[model samples]
Target chain A: MVNTVDPSGPKPRRALSARNIMLYGTLMVVSMYYLLPLYVMVVTSLKGMPEIRLGNVFSPPLEITTAAWTKAWSEACTGINCDGLSRGFWNSVQILIPSVILSIGVASVNGYALSHWKFKGSETFFTILIIGAFIPYQTMLYPIVILLREIGLMGSLWGLVLVHTVFGMPILTLLFRNYFASIPEELFKAARVDGARFWGIYFQIMLPMALPIFVVAIILQVTGIWNDFLFGVIYTKPETYPMTVQLNNIVNSVQGIKEYNVNMAATLLTGLVPLVIYFASGKLFVRGIAAGAVKG
Target chain B: MTSQSTAKRPVQLLRNLSAKIASIPMILTALVVFVGGTAWTVVHSFTSSRLLPKLNFVGFDQYERLWSTRRWLISIENLAIYGICSLILTLLIGFTLAALLDRKIRFEGAFRTIFLYPFALSFVVTGLAWQWILNPDFGVQGVVRGMGWESFAFDPLNNSEIVIFGILIAGIWQGSGLIMCIMLAGLRGIDEDIWKAARVDGIGTVKTYVRIIIPMMRPVFITALVLIASGIIKIYDLVVAQTNGGPGISSEVPAKYVIEYMFRAQNLGQGFAASTMMLVSVIVILVPWAYLEFGGRKRG
Candidate 1:
């Protein structure tokens, strides 16, 4: 198996090796397992209702149609509103953009402070924040609801954004703090020598150097805020439901016929944002997850 | 020293005023939301709060009712089965796949991307996909039955006894890829010289991994364990999306129960008690581990 006879020559043929065969075969099988669900979703979404009812979900559609996609986007009913997932899509976008910016903004600043400017009791707060990440969100759900209601932000889009920011702070702050800590202390000292203040050095020096981390943070937040069902469902009004919540309502609602095609289509639509981010930012997505998984 | 520090305190506070100001959100969140909110819930759990929370003490009546409720008990059982199985299977499959991928296999990138793409999508999407795939009429069972095996019963979603396993399948499919990625990183971090040393010592690759590499990767495994354990405790969306605790609430999980009681059933006291139990369970797992991981480090 160690083909070291001629170092510069082409490797000897091991195509039929048992180890190679087993490795590739297992990989292919597992790949098929992972690919199967997405394949079913795409095929089911593209097929007509009649084809779906024909009860062979694995087969490619005989007459492929984008009607389900259109219906899912524009006209499928979630409940009383027949406007499909478009409303939820826009609502998600509204939640995603602001929440992403606000959460990342506060987190980056907090990370910069914790990493560079070590005030008294800062590490205590940082430790608490990190541990808070492990506390189940359910324990704080009602209190947050009450807090948001008192502040007149409950059942509002901005309220949902605030919730996302709060939950997102722990992990995002951890990511940025770790990233910032990896920078040479001499550089921060030099910046301080130039009389740069807290926000100034952060915005001018660290921000530019941490572009990759920022991208990773954005990818993390975008997928997180987009795919959030619990917060969106709990915090927002019915009209302002995010895509995942709306998709669930549309699929699981008992008031109408079970249009599997449209349901799958809506599912795909809700998943599309994160799927695109995952594919486009492939290695960075891995890095983001690694960073998020660091505390764990 | 105390007098000198006290004299410098105001000056120190004013030195990095902006940084101190910036950290206010994090401090407030840690103190107010995580600490204060959790304390509030635990305290309120002792009261008879209904749709609206009040201070009327009930002396563990909520907890008593919660324990006696069949739904809550079923939720606990489902979570236990789901959590234990998910932990074991995810680590096993993830480690196996990572080991295979570490063998300089071709198309490693493509295989990893395929396995991990599911993790990118939400549990809602994963749940819906698996729900369709497990649908008795047109899914795996149906396909198998259509191939001249009429008596093949594979509908875990509908069956009361095995519904949690149905959700487990989706859970593993969505999560194991992440564990694999982490494990692969751990494997990559191992020195190639260790493999050469093993080869020179006439050790089998399987023995090398089990006896040597796995022990070396204990921290990585711990990280993955904590990740999976947290995810297991919060297994709500997948259940809701897949079966919605259906077929007579056979698949209810603690997180789902907490949410359903808190919001839908308008039972605030019951919800708080259930959520407090969840907090207790997490602390039970977290405290000793945190002590070992961080506490020893400080002392040493």
Candidate 2:
């Protein structure tokens, strides 16, 4: 193989050049830095208290165990409830499913209307919505509470679902509107000429064609509502606390002996939903974030 | 005559009614929640509302009290420190990583996946993981001490003076990857011919990036800056998770202050005042940027 090489051809260099070494070296260090906490979390979760206390956090467990994960999932205490993250996990699922569906459904229709069936004063409201995205949630927090209380939905899961829909409207609407606007006008016009009304055309032409954007929207909304601590805390009671709020309580609760293993396991459990979505829909997640960022 | 004219007007109004009906949610949100809610908060900030909202109209008293409060002052100061440092460090680290990744390196996807995974997790998870990793007894300090540097002291969660920096480290860890992705996108958008031309002219890569590429990526940088800045202003969960504003309230932030006063303290007026201040701060940052971004576009 070496003899077959032409002398005039580019010379094959050694595998680790100085430039290559530096590039790879820097990347490796940063990657290690990024990976270190996850490693610590996994390792700490696997070790017993004796092992955790005896060794530094970075060490692999001499004795492997799933006790902490089990405790975190089923038996760890958060306040009076001895039930672990499973309660919070189910609560998150309840909130996640509805919030995702309603927000995407409303945003898609809003986007379709804005892009295709523009009426007087629509653009003005759209502008206001986009600008309102930058407004801090604090500005509306108390008022929303009062509004929800007035409607007798305060401290309920439905209230949170409504809040998520209101908040998610701006970004999701922008996503769908931009996506719909990018579709060639002729397709919309063709549907119109064939006597398709607004709902009919939307259901037939737009929904199927915009499935990718729907995926992007779903990814965005699921991660967002799942990871939400502020709304979950403010809108829900102790019985309905989402996974993030419950996880924080379990880890940070002052009354108990600090179970570092259980805390790490709980943390991992709370993060699993979005992590799974992220790893599974890798490029789509990137696309979703990119779409969210560009308009901001 | 009036009835017939009114009937004709209703018919005209019914034109494109489906679009209008579809937009009711956006309209209600924009007008009722956003505009009306902000107005309500600002108005009530002037009142002496205790538990429930009341319009007792005590002009600027809440504001005065808020400014003079020690925790509020500390919170503002921490926000300033955290905001400035997080902004600079995230951009620097993010851009550097992006540049490294942009260099046609091996294992780009693996490296990116590693970096961005933390971002997928919530601030709560990030905070907890870092809190454990930074714990004094069983964490970095202990590890180093075991390695024979017994005097090494690096516990930001406990030290009041440097607690914000501890949070800052975690913040950067979770956030810089995102900035890297955005920066990489900006880098990819640069024309290949620009690099070719620069290479043909014997301009070094570093010099070209510093002198040319950065300036070309101005909009991308601005977008990233706005995103980071907004996030910094609303930084509550991370603090709640990591420090809970402990080390005697050294890591307290504005959002936490607002929430506590509104709910815990049962002082709606105070929360209103604090939230109004947050609104003002956001306006201070947003208006000029918006003007430059949208207004200048219109004028041009």
Candidate 3:
């Protein structure tokens, strides 16, 4: 982003010069490629079914309609349930709030301990935990199912919340671990020298200073748990399916008429939360994901 | 090992008790779920554990059955094709976009926001959008035909032969931006002096990139490769939302096969074997990278 000058480069010229044209031209084409689906989804969602069948997905609607949006929000059915995606939306909210809070709370504490406390064999456990992140969730899914069944939380939203917390721990812990480790060791020593124990330092000093990373972790988990289809489908019954799972079922269910307009509307609705988070917390979202690429 | 492991002292055991108490969730997750669970599955895969994972050791039967199944083979082939193509194209496209945006051009932020927005959407949303776009009647093919390109066929989603590629198109759109952001960070990390020296040598921009910049950014490339490779092995929701492994199960992948057998078909042993194979593929991809990244380093 820094405009470091290249002394040997072409002279500064008008905006419509040959080089500028080529550069902007390529960028514009690529931009369109990225934006086209969103454009199509919105355009298709706004048109009625008959008009959509006329076969111009790129055109603006002649007569716009809000019927598809309402239908997708309330009237579209999945199986015996004729109620639309609002149920799934609320279910996701139920899953999202607790999962995000519990995961970040546990992970932030774990990160603080690993960086500052350094107990026996802590690194071994930490290494195993980090390596666990790369393990395919399919391998671990059944065992966790059995774990949930034993506790009688199977097919419940809280069970899915626990599942999200355990799976999310590795990355969130690492995100906070690498962050807390970079803090000067002197800060911890100073706090300890003042006779402050673990809880006092963590609650007073670490919590306030760690606000930004908390935002990043929240963004990561909110978008992740909301967009999760696998855990939602596997852990919860139809009554508690998350938005993504229900969206897929509604759009892909074989029994229904293929209502493309309603399907697009539902798809857009499913995607709205994450898209909003990504746009609103633009650079922090980038930082959160980029943290994954950073090695221990 | 810390002093407590060797000393076995009571004080060391009680030292930082709150920290250790807090780490119980983490320790249980690492030891019980990740390690113990994987071992349990691998062990059970050898048993005749059907319908409810009741173990009655039947060594290699599940493996034999899995290898001989037609669906499993197609899934492997589909994964191999998808993985290779996705890797090459993502790195190429990701790096190229990074390079373009690094040009200090106008509206770089706007360009990046556009390119990366799809990464924010779930695969379910992405798949359905593309599914509608690839609809044979009212989608790109129809639009193209209506625009006078008669006889032009482009319906990959419904066609069993190329359904995977149809999924691949949606996959790249949703994922490449993350790699782009990573590669841009790597490009930024390169000293500006490198570019100055390349320009001084009169080397072209593309040449300088291939010969100098890319080779220098090997670590970043590896990180991105590992991220993409791990992501590629778990391509379930996208396929489910897109084709549902349709056209007579021609588009099925290993994850879907595992899910189908274990959850739906009541064949736990088969799903166990299929999932174990997935775990193996992931380990094969991960171990070498972990060694290269962390094995040699010493903890302070």
**Chain A TM per prediction:** 0.95, 0.95, 0.95
Write one digit per residue (lDDT tens) for candidate 2, span B156-251.
Answer: 999999999999999999988899999999999999879777766767778989999999999889889998999999999999999999999899
Residues A1-296 of candidate 1 have per-residue lDDT tens digits of 34323343344667778768878998998889999999999999999988888867798889889999999999999768998899999999999999999999999999988888878788888888988999999999999999998999999999999999999999999899988999998999798788777777888999999999999999999988898899989999999999999999888888878888998999999999999999999899999988877534
Scored by DockQ, the top model is: 1
Better of 1 and 2 by lDDT: 2
- For model 1, the chain A TM-score is 0.95
Q: Please, what are the lDDT tens digits per residue for candidate 3 over residues A1-296?
A: 11235566664656776667778899999999899999999988999999998857788889999899999999899998979999999999999999999999999999988988888778888988988888888899899999999999999999999999999999999988888888887998798788677788899888888999999999989988898999999999999999999999899888957899999999999999999999999899898778745421
Give the chain B TM-score for each candidate.
0.94, 0.94, 0.95
DockQ of 2: 0.52
Candidate 3 backbone collisions, by pair: none
Give the 10-residue window scoring lowest on summed lDDT in candidate 1 chain A: A1-10
Q: List the residue pairs that clash in candidate 2.
A: none
- Candidate 1 colliding pairs: none
Error of 2 at B190 (Å): 0.8
Model 3, runs deviating above 4 Å:
A1-14, A293-296, B1-15
What DockQ does every candidate get? 0.62, 0.52, 0.58
Ranking by lDDT: 2, 1, 3
Candidate 1's C-alpha runs over 4 A off are A1-13, A294-296, B1-13
